[model samples]
Target: MMQLLIVDDEQIEREGMKFILQKSFPSLEVLEARNGKMAIEIAKTIKPDLILMDIKMPGISGLEALERIMEFSTDIKFIMVTAYDTFDYMRKAIKLGASDYLLKPSKAADIVETVGKVLKEIVVDKRSRAASKRQETVIQKTRSIIEADLVTQLLFEHVHEVNVDLLIDMLEIDRNHEVFVMNVLVPDSSDHPYPLIKEKVSELGNCLVGALSGNQLPIIVFRDKNVSFRFQATSFAKKIITVKQHHEALGWFIGIGNVYSELNQVKKSYQESLVAAMEYLSPAKYRFYAEIEIVEEDFFDLRLTTLKKDIVDQIKLGQWEAIRTEVLSLVQFFEQQGASLVYSQQRILEVLWVVSRVLNDLGIEAKSPLFAFQTIDYRQLRMETGQLLDLLKQKHIHYYQQLEADNVQQIKQYIQAHSHEEISLETLSVEMGLSPIYISKLFKEKMGINYIDFLTECRIEKAKKLMQDPRRSIKEIAIEVGYHEPNYFSKVFKKMVHVSPKEYQNAIHGK
Candidate 1:
């Protein structure tokens, strides 16, 4: 219920106004104050929705009380009640934020009309504020989804050219700013503390937290120009550790990757972070990519880097033989380098772990690559590593053998059918029971174009068909063909069709 307070020095005046208000607005909770001071106190206590103040009052004038009350409660509606109808008095009341003025000898109808107008305004203001708050909440949720999707695209899948840049802009991160990936390994038994970890990262204000995938939670931290990289990474790692310490049973490990200036290159950082976490025997809760004790000269060799990338690419392409050959070759290179047996095995395990991660990303569940026992000789190492590779190959083959032969056809059909809606690789991934990366690779290889390109083609073709209807507006056609913004729709149409949407529409109708 709305509350109104009447303030006047004369008790009869206050009582008369309250009686009239109570009779007109039976539901209104009417309050009374004999002076401006009392009016301020009542407003502060009861927080009334409206106030009626007499210009003439003891101790403090009506305008003075209006100013005092407004200082603390700007939402309260005010009406100045006075006998004087001078322009000066009206101006002063208006200047002091009075909602409406009530002449001292006003009729009951006039009193009710003025109070009702102010009350209606208060209700409208409340509704508008509520709507704005709801909009803000929706925007926050949409942003979180976009952030998660962006992280997935950058780390696990090919970035779609049509939306990745726009998404980066929407996320408001400077592309010039460097970024690094932090991978958190949460044990399977512990209740996933994703919300708590996200809350802690949000305090830093520049991190994008990805959805928890199995046991790994990835965070991309933007470099702060003022802070050293180590300081920022260390501080955040400690905060994550603090969250982990709360759950003693959960063995949480964090891996910090090397910093990269380009967003696209951050995938490499993600890979490094995974390798860093491979050292599960480390006493510390967190490990940095740079802290991996492998000899720097051998570790940073360009040939090794290229070979690792090849293994990742081959895994996505489902070329198990190629992947196996690459793994053994990598082992051979390490052997010829005269690296220690333990060090070589560790490096080989790291490479195998990368393979396991890539397979996991492709929606293929593979066990973490580990040798049965520490190898004491090069021959034993090769035999054990080969066996692990063969096991992984069988898992990959088994997963694909279960998939429908025409998965690509199904994806193409889905896009063609749903082109008029918001479609993304992530959406298709969910629908097809495949990872976005695997779907993207398959679509490109089989269809000879990116999935996003195919989706755009479908939308544009539909838009062309829609354009044939002379009755439809360009904006309506854009919306019907899945583009929300007419301007962007027109831009894409021009790029693909070699003419603007309007120009094409004009040509078709001879307008």
Candidate 2:
């Protein structure tokens, strides 16, 4: 129970006030002292939360005791109770730390009202403190859990367009502003106290930092334009060093990546810094990863670079089969090289994004579930990377198959509609938004014949049917079938049908 002390020289006044207080507030554990000296001694043990002191007291004045007691417990509330309601006395008591006052011949209602007001203040103060604690907890979890997981998923795939407001709202970051990634690699995770370091970093304004939940503890820093990535990374490294030495948690390293302006590039920066820190993770020092050194290789197969170029060229040519094969080969190369799961996941996703950009260039939107990036689940499929590749290949197959069929339909429809308009593959190329070579190649693959061959077949078939119409001359019929001269039309007719136009006309007449 909360303790309240009543200090008075008169036994009757102390007992009377105690009775009224007890009746008004039964929750208070009321204690009494006859004089200021006794009040001080009793408070030393009971540590009363509120005091009712008389101005005139035996042994020592209430003001003197209050001054001394405040030196020990300034938070304790003091209420001066005196028979003299002089303004001078009131001023002196107020100066000596009295929170409130009561006049002589105090009624029960007045005493109850004064104590009740102090109790009410205590309740209000307690509520405020509780609210502050809850708010802090909410902020902590928001940055540590929700924000961290969302960030992780995004890094894995081109997940939906990132919610920029996520950082601004949860982390207090200005997503429009510049940001960079700082990695703190503590091999001995148990030794370094990251939460404390994160708390201190948060105290500094104009930055958002979060400790991800995983074996590798990465700290993402969203900073104002004034703070450079190098400076922030180095400063944070020093801070970690200080914390380590202070707490005797000594082995750790920090890696810093280049600063970026766009929020979408955060994952790129994160991967760069992560690779740097992971390279020399254990030396208890910091490294600026802005310039990751590339050592010379013994066997550099130029085909790897050639393969990437070849696949992109194929994308431009609209060869889905070739593009899909090259993409799979890239993954196979990464697997054969024994690249780390994280490294492979990052690189393959990048390669796929480059491939997806092909669709965007051709005014095609990528809507496959596999293309979502988040669905890849790199963390879960670290061992079964082949499954991810297979899923991606399937999506590519379905998307391109439908697209190729559409292309075939358009090409055939346009040909039938303008067969006599002197049509060529180049004209169809512009009409279908595809390269001439790709259109020809796809035409044969889908229609089972070369484009010109199909055109020749359609023309000859139309001419034979036109031969049944005796109302038109041979030259007019040639012009109608896209040939400018009757001789050329007769030559094509003889070559295709084994009979000249007049011979066929005579044969029809004889029949």
Candidate 3:
């Protein structure tokens, strides 16, 4: 309910104004303060929406009380009341932020008009603030969804050319900065610790925490120049571990990857983080990829670069025969180099792991590639590696066999139909029963655009149509096209259409 406070030294004046306000504004709660001193006290405690102060009062003057209240409560509206209509008193009241003024013997209609005007302003201001708060909430939620999808794109799937840059722009992160990946492996299914972990990570520094995919949670940490990489990564990992330490039974593990200057190479860092996470037997709960005792010297040979690319491409293409050829050829090259069978097996295991992860990105949940037993000789090594490849290939084949050819089109239609509602990759993943990573990959490969871009296109197109009607406001058009905040809608529209919504509307009307 609205509250109004009447401050006058005369008991008769306070009572008269209270009765007048109560009769006209039946809903307003009237408060009484006999003097400026009492008025200050009541204003502080009650925080009335409006105050009618008699200009002259005992002890503290009305102007003094208004000034004191103004210091603490700027939102409270004030009106000056006095028998004198002198310029000095009127000027003083105006200087003190009084909204309106009244003569001591004013008519009942005049009193109601002035009080009702300020009351209307208070109501309008309250509604505007509430609307702004709701818009902020919606924008925050949209940013989170975009951040999660960006993490998935960078780490788990191939980056969409059109969407990646736009997503980074929307996230307001530096694209050229170095970044590393961290994999937090939750041992169980409970998601209770995810929010705690994300909150702690945010407090530490800038990072993007992804949604939980199975038990694995990925985070992309931008490099902070103020601290050494080791110190930063170690501190971040330890803090994440502390989140679950109280539970004791959670058994969470963390893996920190090496920092890379390029975003595309971030996937390599993510892969390294997964490899580091596999050091579950280590004494420490967290491990860095560089700290792992893996033989990467031979694995980094320039000769293998082209072959590695070929293997990745072939895996995505599901060219099993070509993939097998590349694997055997890599092993043969290692043998010709006089590399030991153990080293060859290690390198081949790395390749197979990459294949498994790539298949995982394609919606095939292949088991982590591992040899059943150590190969004693090169012959046994080749045989075991072939068996592993065959297993992965069969899973890949089964996945494709069951996937509908029109799945991408169906997803496209769902987005087009629901462009006027909140849509996120996670939501589509749930509805289609596909991993978000796979959905992203499918958009890039089949549609030549990411789903985010497609969704934006749908929204902008709808907004353009709505703009054709001169009767509709930009904010109304924004809501009709799925954006909750008009400013955010304008930004997206401007980014996609090369003009602000107002400019577009003006152009349409020949303004």
Report the Cα RMSD per candidate: 20.8, 28.3, 22.1
Candidate 1 residue lDDT tens string, 1-511: 5689998888888888888888766557898898889999998999998999888777998888999999999888899888865547767889878889988788987997788777767755654555577856655675677688778878875555534654575566677779999998776554658878988888887888888876688999999879899999999998887787666644477889999998879998998897776655457888898987675454545655676678667876778888778778867877887887766776787777667777886799975665545578888988999999888888888887656447988998999999998888899989999999989888887778999899999999999998898889999999988999999999999999999998999999998
lDDT of 2: 0.65
Model 1 C-alpha lDDT versus the unseen true structure: 0.81
Show model 3 residue runs off by greater than 4 Å: 1-140, 153-157, 160-162, 176-178, 185-197, 211-216, 242-253, 260-283, 292-325, 328-346, 367-390, 400-511
TM-score top scorer: 1
Question: Which is the winner by TM-score between candidate 2 and candidate 3?
Answer: 3
Per-residue alpha-carbon lDDT of candidate 3 for residues 293-406, written as tens digits (9 for 90 to 100): 554465545535665567667876878888888788878877887886655775677677677767776678865665655578888888888999999998887777556447
Q: CA lDDT of each candidate?
A: 0.81, 0.65, 0.80
Clashing pairs in 2: none
Per-prediction TM-score to the true structure, in the order listed: 0.47, 0.34, 0.43
* Model 3: how far residue 199 lies from native, Å: 4.0
Better of 1 and 3 by lDDT: 1
Worst 10 residues of 1 by lDDT: 295-304
Clashing pairs in 3: none
Error of 3 at 172 (Å): 2.3
> Candidate 1 vs candidate 3: which has greater TM-score?
1
Q: What's the true lDDT of residue 407 in model 2?
A: 88
TM-score quality measure for candidate 2: 0.34
Which digits, one per residue and each the tens of the lDDT, describe model 2 over residues 245-300? 64543325566777778666777777667546543423447776655443222222
lDDT of 1 at 105: 87
